[model samples]
Target: MNLHGWIIYNGNLPGNKFLDFAQWIQAAATRKNSTTTIYKNNELLSYLGIGQLEVLRQDKNKLPDYVVFADKDIYLAKQLEYLGVPVFNSAEAIDISDDKIATYQRLAVKNLPIPRTIIAPKIFVSGQLDKTTVQLAMESLGFPMIIKESFGSFGEQVYLIYTEEELYKMVESLQGKAFMFQEFISSSYGNDLRLQVVGDEVVAAMKRSASDDFRANVTAGGTMTAYKPTQQEEKLAIAATQAIGADFAGIDLLFGPNNSPIVCEINSNAHIRNMFDCTNINVADYIIGYILNRLN
Candidate 1:
């Protein structure tokens, strides 16, 4: 039971899946005489059998030297922190970065330029809905604004409201969840930069083209092409990662009306698979190595 490293990857393994990553790490550690353990939530439950209280009673305190939580389960990472397990990016960082509003707030406080934004109440369901409120928000923030759910990913819960009617409809539709409305930054190039940063280093970068549709996420049918960040843009990305204490992040920057760079969002568990072929850097390996070195 001498485990070398532990991987907290999501999904089941060894059943239409593989432990090759853990195996590779184990091999890396074997030179120092150790093995690796792959801990998926499914596999953990299967091995532990019944309940959490029962499992906790067993006192399996001999955890691996380093544990990398690959998934975006913020709560699980925080729980591991209580167990003194070194986690990548820290649970708090993940929690903060998960919220678009909170992440933007943190960046703004750090003097980072973000799109002029404001959060709007999601409730306007009844009679005499506050038209004045919506009107003021649009006027103060300006029109052609973008509304977003505080915790959505991949352009899923984001919308653009160019008119008061669209804004009202969006507010009525998302009546229970918190939303943010931000001034739309017009990048004449019709693209935004997705900068992948690790430990103050801008490792991989890409240019995402929004098909006249406006949402810059690929899920919204936006195209992603290889991009190289200018030194200033790289500085902005690094500063943003540091602002949120994120060990790994995807800092989304868009060009404003004068080519001014404005941060639109930050993703904690940024998917690197899309950027792999475009950059010379192996982001996954770099992330794995960075976490192992820092947390170990």
Candidate 2:
């Protein structure tokens, strides 16, 4: 059957990165004898009326057979699903993957290996944290730990706190934000693995490192090298993807004391351009092929 798809991405985000991803998917789908149109999340409006739910696009009213959701706009993704259009990675997967606290909770329930983490209590108004609570969290995770906001990307919202003053200051600055405290993986400092998994297979893998920064995100000035994942590494990456119910994902694995794999983070809408550059593999081909097969 000839397939049609929509590659949806965030339009408001600066730079061409998001649109670039959509175009890549569109090109891949076309190569596979399928047709796809790129749409920005803002271009499609979701409406609610008495006993009706609808999404209307300014240029087109036709919905595709499937949607390659490359945005973190969970509500729009869910709206598409509610309209009975199949969405890759699913809305729930994106929601869970977008929130670190939720992602870790799901992984922990599945017995996946992750860094020791403590979710900060939610505060509506910006304010200071309780001294006793901060003290207990510090005692449990120790100094020189990691502080990560729940909703972040490109390693932008992650921090390393050394002294109590630094920790408190960082926490205070993040007042009213959903964040977490984590045990820093000293063994994997400035290094981690990015394994792209599609349909239970590791299509491509790369090791990311940074000399000047602790975060291994390439967008954060890190470097990437093609990697051959170990059996355990591959297994864990795939398992972590499944744990979040994602059809595909980029799973970041940290090195444990003995080089054991520990999931650092999972990206449901992970960018594949870097993987292609490092591994010379177009993961888009694997992703398009997987979607076609599933639809067939």
Question: Model 2: per-residue lDDT, tens digit, 1-296?
Answer: 89899999998999999998888899999999999989999998888899999998877658899999999999999999999999997999999999999999999999999999999999898767888879988999997899999999999899999999999889899999999999999999999999999989999999999998889999999999999999999999999999999999999999999999999999998999999999999989999999999999
Pick by lDDT: which candidate is best?
A: 2
Encode model 1's per-residue lDDT on 1-296: one tens digit a residue. Answer: 34346666566433322344344434445544445566664443312234431213133646656665555666667666666667776888888888888898899899999988887654545443367777888888777788888988777887877888888888777776777878877563357889999887888999888767777777577888888788988999999999988888889998877777788888876766667655655576667667656643
- Root-mean-square deviation of every model: 4.8, 0.8
**Candidate 2, residue 266: lDDT:** 97
Worst 10 residues of 1 by lDDT: 46-55
- Check candidate 2 and list the clashing pairs: none
Q: Which stretches of candidate 2 lie over 4 Å from their true place?
A: none
